[model samples]
Target: MSTESNSRGNHSAENGSSVHHVVQIDASFLSEVEGKMEELPRLLNRSAGRDSCCIFRVPQSLSEINERAYQPHIVSIGPFHHGEPQFQMIQEHKWRFLSDLLLRAESKRVVLKDFFEAVAPMEEPIRKSYSETLEFDGQDLIRMMVLDGCFIIELFCKVGRIVPADLDDPLFTMAWVLPFLMRDLLRLENQIPYFVLQKLFDLSVGSGNDDPSLAKLALGFFNYMVQRPLHVLVKYYEKKGVHLLDLFLMSYIPDCEEEVRRPSRFLHLIQCAKKLNQAGVRFKPRKTHSILDIKFKNGVLEIPVLTMDDFWSSLFLNFVAFEQCYRHSTKYVTTYATLMGCLINTPADAGFLRDHKIIENYFGTDKEVARFFNNVGKDVVFDIHRSYLSKVFEEVNEYYQNDWHVRWAGFRHKYFDTPWSFMSAVAATVLLLLTMIQAFYAVFAYQNPPKNH
Candidate 1:
């Protein structure tokens, strides 16, 4: 009986030791969790401060359509793509451009130190402009801001003829290189804040009463891509933009009244260009300040002439991506792309628009243009009631649904589509009338028994 009692005591001791070990582990885990909870406030603080984030990384749903459209090919401007290997050549040119600006600043009593000092106070705001948490430290970000900003300002000045460009500078001498550089500069990921450029410009090349403003200089450099008149561009020069891409986009927005809030509905896609034409809708090319200014009046649909090239394709893709990602942005570009996609469902639809001088197809064949629109318009989130072209869509769809118009249009298209067919139709009509008249005369002669002639 004593031995049995000793064994029970030993088992109790082992059970106590196991319980102690489990309690220790639970206490340690609880302490670790409590320690991690301390960081919640900091995370929330960072998130709350992100209201200034205007620049965004393109979301995967949009980028998956065309990854290269959102990425920089020749140059890297912002932290998202900085220090990339392929951009090293442009990185060297950035230094060269900075050197030129420094030389110019020397005459104005502005030094490199002045540029850095001007941007130093803006580091926090600059960091908050990007959507992602940047890995760049204070000194590295400041240097990037100064370098990229000055290079853009100098390039604009040189191109605008505000400052003379070097005779040997390949960026200006090589025509092909300038186009790619221009495209890269306007990319979504490849941008520094416009305020940084303005600060650098004000310090390095003080604006004169007669001299072009930074906005003007920027517009001048990118105007070739858009081909807007100077007067139209001048109107938006005073408006502040977040970055170069935003500035370029701002130029294309129509200077019209604010969009009025209307009842929301499911925005349906309209018929293709070929189908609309067959349904008695007329297509006309319009010349407007903004390409997004599309209109439908009566039975005619008017669209501004669009020049499509490789540069335009890339530009539009980025523009749509930006509108999709950014909340404050208007859906003008997105609406235009979606409208085009609705109108061009096939190669024949593209060809019809091409014949009407509505689309200048420099990108590729009609099939390619059709495919481009289809691809761009996919996976986009748009509210038609908020869109500027919502009225046009409603009118076009309403017109297309009319049975009388479609029947008449189909009849005309089938019988009188070509000149030969029209002539044959007229001749057949005349022959039928003559046959009826002859039968009536013969019936009258037989019934009345008139004298034979």
Candidate 2:
């Protein structure tokens, strides 16, 4: 009995001892975690010291609303959309374009290896250009850079007529493909670095490239994409562009003048075209091709002619996204789009612009154009203070808000909206004038008796 009691006592003692055992944390585990925390700041400093990353994934705030807007519809260019199965068909065409480019370069003694070697050294810088670190190895990246660079250069040459068009070229032969390609190239996700293209062009064409500079050829190609017949005034400034979308944005912004001075603050509520018209304000299409150059003077708002097409919404949304993403980038395109959105609230407003020949609507009905302007800037955040047309908007809005302007506008709209109404107003004015003359004669005759003389 005593032994059995001692055994129970020992078991209880063993369990109590096990329960009180202390855990010892390894010093190495703690050190490793602390080391990682210490390394974070150095990593950030290293990234900051490097050249600013240019290419970026579309901010979720911008892309989440319309994921398709940033995606290429017809073709993919860079690593972001490289492996998508839907865009795989165009890879063959890119290779074809590269082959054609080499054939054309034969006269300049340029071979495929020369192009590949030229782009090899640029791989590191090119990878750094993208905001997100690309996960491609040296060989894969170099190959992508070479192929994409050649395809872009060849495209610009073909579109600008720098090289003779191939008879069986799909881009030229198929009428529907060109417009889609233009839209695809301008997409935020589907862009290669412009430097890559320029370098490839120099290597392939030597000094034989017709255009004086690569910028000129690129601007010319942009004009073709927009289908504008006028020559765009591209300043010979050394602004480094991140991608095709960046280039397109910079085309409208003038050098040395980043922001237009905002007019002094006042009631800035710009009326629609119909309202402005009724308020005795005039609308005229400016001869310039820059859509950002909207002006107002002497009750005349001179807006540059805008071409609206099937791709207008996609083009505009991407432009807005680019402006939203970049810090140094101006909100000129955003402002222009907002102004258009303000001016055209409905189909009637669109018709008013069309009647003034300010907007060429190649899309569909006025409603579609109106809706296009209204929705293009969805999820896009912009500051009006930075808009170039701040002053113009202020003036237009203040002018439209004056009590006299409102009354006159209302009167004109109420009484003179149609030809019959205008004629009736003229007739009433004439009758009032005759009545006043008769009354004056009666008063004069009764007071001075001038009739007797």
Candidate 3:
């Protein structure tokens, strides 16, 4: 019995020993954890310095809807897409552009070393301009900035006619290539900081009293996107922007004071074009510089004519993605996109807008245009009450919800939607009135024989 008890005690001791060994942590593992913990403050500091970051990689949620909209097919501008395999062909052109810029700069006594020296001091701030930590080393980043910046400035100069474009230049010779390049340049990821471009432009081109600013040159280069009046471009040329994309976006924003209004309790989407038309809401093409300047008055909704093409689609998608990702950016483009999505639900709605001349659909069919808006507005989140178009939305919805308006509109649409239908209704009313008059006279004649004589 004593031996059996001793055996049980030994087994219990062995179990306890096993549990202790399992619970024990290695000294090396603790040291490694401590090392990682030490990195936390450095990581925090690095993140904190990224407040100036305006350029971003489009979020996966937004990009997955349409990857081509955010990606550059012709050229890679910044570190986000640098060294991409598809962008290799454009790299040769970039070097050629750089050579041209250098030749032009030589007359002004500026050299390659001057550009490198100018950008080297700005490497840290330039790196921080991007949302993500760039993997390029100091030298590589500086080289990219000089090379890319020079290419863009030179391209802008040639396109803006500040300098003559090479007669044999494929970018100019090929009709399709310049449009693609313009689209690529405006991409959110395909941008360097505006300051970098400014410095490079000033160095290479040497700004003069008569020489247009880089902003002007850029606007001129991208003018085909909107074809706004020269005065409009001149007005926005002096406005400061973080980058080229921001500059282009700023041009579209209306120069109106923000209205002081209480936030709406709940957000609402206005009805599509077809429903609105059915409800007697008239759509007129607004004559305004800003596309966001949509107005509602009485029973009419006036909207600026929007040209929908592949370039505009890509431009708007990136604009919306930027507004969504960047906190400091105003949600003008996103709000416009959401409003467009609400107003175009199907091919019929698109067709209605097309008929009204509110939407110039260069995109395939009405169905494709509808799909474009739907895809753009997918998964987007914004505060409708604070939107620039909030009042427009509220007024439009209120007008649509009125029972009297709907009934009257329904009556008019059912009866007088066409000129022939309106004429028929008028004739029928006259005929009914004449018959009533004849019946009254007949009743009088029957009641009094003398009156008949």
Candidate 4:
């Protein structure tokens, strides 16, 4: 009866019902067998905790007996992009890191003298990748600084200056994505603007780095691009509203040579919730999954990462796949595709209307923007001389006629013309009318008053 009760108790514990059990063991058996423990196996086996008994299968024998056992409690944490040992802390650190970099990059110096001094640090940090085995050539940095078109190129050729690096050691290696975003910030005049992004990708594919340091950097950099577009291309035709996302849904790049018609990098981004109100907002990863859930509940970010499903229903098909291709290596494309496919197959919000609202407006309306410039001073407003804006718009229209926006606009035109297409709608209508009339006459003619012929 005791054995039965203990067994029932174990079962109850296993079911999580919270039960208690008491077992009576022979004390003399333990004392007598204490010295010769090998002989005390029977007595030791049945002694255990509050709810169950510890059964010992006879040593070296597969004894199949039905006995209840208490299971050890287990908790699991989700995988993260990098050192997201804890999601909440990681998130806070991410922004803190960004603000620090921004101050160094943009706010540190304003006057021409300070700007020149800042360039000294920019030439190259005294030490690059102090924490990891990363080696950054000083010249390599000039390439990054001159990311914007005319400004960077002209500055490199004309100014020909050097800079000292500020950050000596980073707690974690910044992800490679961070470089692309910084380059984007340089105003998109990079000689090989997307080259950094591609190189990071290559690293992810085969660099065999266990940490994915460069990959994480790339993610952070792109996040910055979401907020600050490379101004040089901001006004360009094919480039307007284009993002760090190098590929489009219908874009022709493949994650791997063996892959075919795969998803683009843009889709995975939406699925990631990296963007807030369409602007890339910064976030840090969590150490544990539950913490991420709690943070999500509190609405730390403009949009919570967990809310990805809510937005998935609204993504454009090709765009969603585009993002998946970047989110992982080509080897995982099929798997990513399967998961996204499930979402695609389910009922979702249709998010395909190409938003023509200019990127500037999306940031804030003209009134607010005007106020920002006015506060900056009259010179700041005059800096973009109408001539400059006009020239930029004209050049972009001419050079990038086939850019994403331009192409999308052309497609919109084709779509809008459907009603007015003479050969399509009008001709089809005429043909339909003629067919109907003939059918009516044929049916009536058969009954033609048996004319009297």
Q: Which candidate leads the pack in TM-score?
A: 3
lDDT of 3 by residue, 164-280 (tens): 887988888989889999999999989998899999988988778977888888898899667989988898877668888999999999865335347553337788888888777
lDDT of each: 0.85, 0.76, 0.86, 0.29
State the displacement of the C-alpha of residue 443, model 1, in Å, after optimal TM-score superposition. 9.0
lDDT of 2 by residue, 1-453 (tens): 367766776787888843233357899999999988876342122332344555667777767666787888778888888978887777888998898899988998889999888888888778766666677799998898899878877888888888887878877798988777788888876878777877887887654544446666666776766655544534632344777778777777643243555446552546678878888778999987577788888778999888887576678878887777666667878888888888898899999999999999998899998887777666777666556677777788777767897787788887888999999999999999999999999998888874545
Tell me how many clashing residue pairs each candidate has: 0, 0, 0, 48
Clashing pairs in 2: none
Each candidate structure's TM-score, on Cα atoms with residue i matched to residue i, is 0.87, 0.82, 0.90, 0.18
Deviating ranges (above 4 Å) for candidate 3: 1-22, 38-50, 257-260, 263-267, 439-453
List ranges where model 2 is wrong by over 4 Å.
1-51, 207-212, 229-240, 254-280, 444-453
Tens-digit lDDT track of model 1 for 83-178: 989999889999999999999889989899999999999999897788777877899999999999988888998888888888888887888878
Q: Which residue segments of model 1 deviate by more than 4 Å? A: 1-50, 256-267, 432-453
The residue pairs in collision within model 3 are none
Candidate order by lDDT, decreasing, is 3, 1, 2, 4
| lDDT (Cα, 0-100) at 53 in candidate 3 | 76
For candidate 4, write residues 49-109 as lDDT tens digits. 2112111112111111101111101110111012223334433433443333334344423
